[model samples]
Target: MTPTSALLSTRPWPLLLLLTLLLPGLVQAQQPTAVIAARATLSSWSDPLESLGTLRADESVTLSATVTDIVRELNFRDGDTVEAGRLLVRLADDEAQADLRAAQALRDERRNAVNRLAQLQSRNLAPRADVEDARAQLRQVEAEIQALEARLADYRIQAPFDGRVGFRNVSLGTLVTPGTELVTLDKLDVMKLDFTLPEVVLGQLAEGLSLTATSPAFPNAVFAGEIASIGSRVDPVSRSVTVRAELDNPELRLRPGMLMNVVVQRAPRNALVIPESALIPQGQRQYVLVLDEDDDYRVARREIGIGARRAGEVEVLEGLAEHDLVVAHGTERVRDGQTTRLLGILDDDTSIPELLRRGRDQAEANG
Candidate 1:
């Protein structure tokens, strides 16, 4: 049993009360229940497919090394924002600089020799073979010098792209080798949300469909996104397909690795709605205790084609009308053909927008 079930199960008296109440004319006629009721409503039913999703950075990287050396300087602090090619870290480049100077000297000497040989070749005084050999030697030395220059530049590490840098795992003055971890960089301007959908929903899924998601950090704020990708293959065991949505996280608050609830809404259509608490499930049969025109409370069987639930209201389909009134609470004490009066509704949705505004006003006043 669930924790709620266990707590309520503490008393077997309610179970007995329910059994007696369901019996025909078992409860005394003079007894009146303090129950709740809500007038039925018509809503633009939204076929919103909701699921748990995880947020991830659109791009991430582990900045490391291409050359090994003693650490000299770290250009950024932990959690600093960096741009593409911005200096991040640097290593001791004394050896690299020496090698560069040596390469330049050799290259200069070779160039002079090549120039002298070319003049002689023009005069037809130097051997043609000598000129060819000088050209090859110059080219060889020049190529080596270029390679050394590149290695020297690698000593100063720079950011590869615009991103926020993570905590520095290593400190300055620490000797590091090639592939040593420096820091992590993440582009958080956009995020990707990953979720799975039943195979039946795959038919309606498409690229650029809208998504609304909520997280605990910002309770009232809803983040929007569009379908970025959908897996072509379905999982055999779960019969679901993977889906990814791209979110524009402009505030940089929607961080990667956040767990959240995602709601995918289709176009709005018509549906009948009643309070969720009113719908009671007896075995496989779903029933709602409702009040008819004659002010009689009865356990009415309903074929419920369910839809999205929002703001404490549940959308119902089949066997209901807008003018219908459903018993919101006190259902456990009601029976089929039991006479009951209209009690105040707990989830009455009449004038919802006004009610919501009033709630907000009351909260502000209380605060």
Candidate 2:
């Protein structure tokens, strides 16, 4: 007998055990590995520019008294919303009111005298000079009444615009004078966000560019706004330009002097994007398994240049094209030139188990 046959016969059980182990490996090597893949798609991508910003009211003012007097009537409380021309405070105007009434009564008497003089002069009983003098006296009294009315106005304080008032600085019976801050008023229906950006990006900035802002106070809420104005001149010291954005504050959630994080959204352009899971990092290099449908769905390892990433997606700058299928799951079981069974295309919501179950059901129905 041949030497090989003799050895095999002497160790028959050992040979059988080796064959049993080798048979499954050979079968497994030939079977296609099931994998879920995603197609690289052209999607809108915006390069976001981030910076710190401060929130400001659309209009703000410090309300104060215009004259020195004791506070008589307090028309507004702390944090009261008022409209334009709303009465807010009335100083002690008793003396001014009394003077106005006296002047008005004197004006009435002078007018009656002028009328009576004119009636007599028409009959040639009164001289024309006397009639003219009476008319002049009436005009003088009317001017005095006007002066007193203006004086009374200075004793009252009214809102200049529609806004919300801050805490009261003066209380009832408190004596106040010109420039004494009584309160603060701010238009809170719309808020202004001011931030600075490097002048290098001035070419890309324009009024009406959309942006988003966020505050630590509201973790989950995102506020939307648009650029309202750009600073006319760049700041020489910082080499940056101030940008103002307007945000509607219908809920009054944004307040003045609040710190916010701003993200300026530049123009969007179409870019090739794939699922982030498709990336395989190898020593600072990113690689992905691209499926070749023309070659029996064989996978080819390709190096790709990556750019910005957001959520579960990544921007592929190179080595990928629109509609190119890449393995998104089960990448570990794949190799170059290895045939793979495509379960389905993956999306933002689908899972690997769901794709496997779908593939199995299809196979069963076909069988």
Candidate 3:
């Protein structure tokens, strides 16, 4: 017999088979264990409703001239905050002033004549017809003066309300006509956001319903508002109902005509939650490897039912019990029925003494 064949024949066949069977187990045990851990938590979860909206001024108007006239003086600078009844513009009133003076003189003359006529009538020195005529003339002259005074008021422009004004379209010598655009005034103490929602959701849209909005201009900031009004009818074309919301704008950061993303919350409920990293998908099924209740740190695959997700957390609708530890951070390296090492629960960083106590307990249990 050859030397190699003789040596192989001397070794027992049962012993050789046993060693081959044990080799795979030894190699698996020597492999480094992946470290990943998370404890399931109970948390509040709500499915958020979202929609697109537009921001608007609470109150807005365009200032204009009441009559045709040349602008003689401007009382406000562009983009100035003004108070109610503050003069904004003055129009040239030279011709109106001349007519007013003439009317006043005629009124004064008529008044003198009426006084004389009254005295004459009391003395019975003049006929009743003459006194009546003189009094009628006085009335006509006083009416004329009043008409002139009313006309003069048209030359002055004043703010109808307290607000901020935009740029003026006319200059000092520019002549403006009635209905001519002068400037814009907006009351910005509060802002109105108008948007539409599908008619199917009419039950959810109501006065006092709270909502939140965000804008690209202020990406990190969120504005809170409430539904102020609902439209009487839904638009036939879009099948949506218009809704308006009011938001307090103390800082005046939000401006009209800005596009915003809006979110509304409905009824919320408490649910068990876990980090999204703990999930693993295979074929058409989703699962998580939870640490088995043993000192060996073995993990088992668990199928889970999921619900609405927000931020980095996912709601566990089923299959996950509270306080159950699962592989979260290093799920990619974990396998079903595989050995692993505990790195503490996710986000469980705390005092060093607690960590040491946990380590000692685990060691004692394993030993």
Candidate 4:
């Protein structure tokens, strides 16, 4: 070809545009599809035992006045963290104080009168019955005074424990009566979530069986705790046993009545695992999507036996090699030998304790 002919043929700009318009399918066939990319990972899946639970504090108490009185002063405000013996509310004690003073004065007077009567009786001036009457009067006054003091003390509301106080219900001068809901007090520094788990695996759950928890208040965050209490007997009807775990809520962030999901960690000395979302069930078989580098990803139907389901992940038993990535998502849509785009890799080999600690830090930072 001549120089001009070569230059004319070299112009791919116009030809490319024509091919784009005329051969759309041919052009598209040469391109790659990034259909909801998901990372391939090997996860050790443990047989999962699903359990339902309700969130609750280990110890929660509501404050109420036992006597009818006007609130003189609220020593502590709402959300106040109080120590044991901390005074919370004080009722109008003017009448009680007056009564106590009168009782004391009358007791003193009766004692003096009794002494005088005893002296008279010894000198044969007063009768034995008179002395006995005086002594009885003094004893009556003393008893009365003690009773008044006891009643006076009840006028003050105190913290029964080292705990956090709820919002104030009755402010200063608010008339409150017996059974009046004053406020809620809870020991949140350490909280417990009472739950029930299937009693079939009683051996799996015991003291020191690890656990992880997360609440809606802080999503993507896990709180750490241990199996604190286990019921001695399992209910035959429900086939479930009560399990309670104590969580260190030092910041008082996790409150009672806050719903949460708990994961009990069974120790894995040398475990295989993968992301939970990666596993898809087809009939009786479960599998994951895995990529072998390049665009050479495949929907691998893995026969994985699992151990424990925890924190959006699971432990695997069979049908997967270490580091052999299984697809995380879209396994149902993918077929064996089909191509896939590698999305991201999830940590399936990290120590459970490390994972728990990292989750706790994330929760604290967010909180």
Best by TM-score: 2
Candidate 3 wrongly placed segments (more than 4 Å)? 1-34, 39-44, 94-153, 266-271, 280-304, 319-325, 332-340, 347-367
The lDDT of model 3 is 0.84
For model 4, residues 233-257, the per-residue Cα lDDT tens digits are 8999999899988888867788788
Q: Each model's TM-score, in the order given?
A: 0.64, 0.80, 0.65, 0.60
Q: What is the lDDT for 253 in model 4?
A: 80
Of candidates 3 and 2, the better by TM-score: 2
Provide the clash count, candidate 1.
0
Q: Write the per-residue lDDT of candidate 1 for residues 1-367, one digit (tens) a residue.
A: 8999988877898888888877756554555554556778776666688999999888999988877788898899888888999989888999888888988898889889989988998999898899889889889888988988888778888888888999998888888998988899999899999999999888898898888999999999999998999997999999999999999988899888998799987665677787777778767756776676564554454555555677767877666777777777667876677666544444534543454456567658966
lDDT at position 178, candidate 4: 89
RMSD (Å) of each candidate, 1 decimal: 15.2, 4.5, 7.8, 11.6
In candidate 2, position 2 carries an lDDT of 100
Best by lDDT: 2
- Candidate 2 RMSD to the real structure: 4.5
- Whole-structure CA lDDT of model 4: 0.74
After superposing candidate 4 on the true structure, give the runs of residues whose Cα lies further than 4 Å from its correct spot: 1-52, 118-132, 232-237, 267-367
Clashing residue pairs, backbone N/CA/C < 3 A, model 3: none
TM-score, cand. 4 vs. native? 0.60
- Per residue, candidate 3 scores C-alpha lDDT tens digits across 286-315 of 799888857567889899988878887898
Clashing pairs in 1: none
The superposed Cα distance between candidate 1 and the true structure at residue 55, in angstroms, equals 1.4
Error of 1 at 75 (Å): 0.6
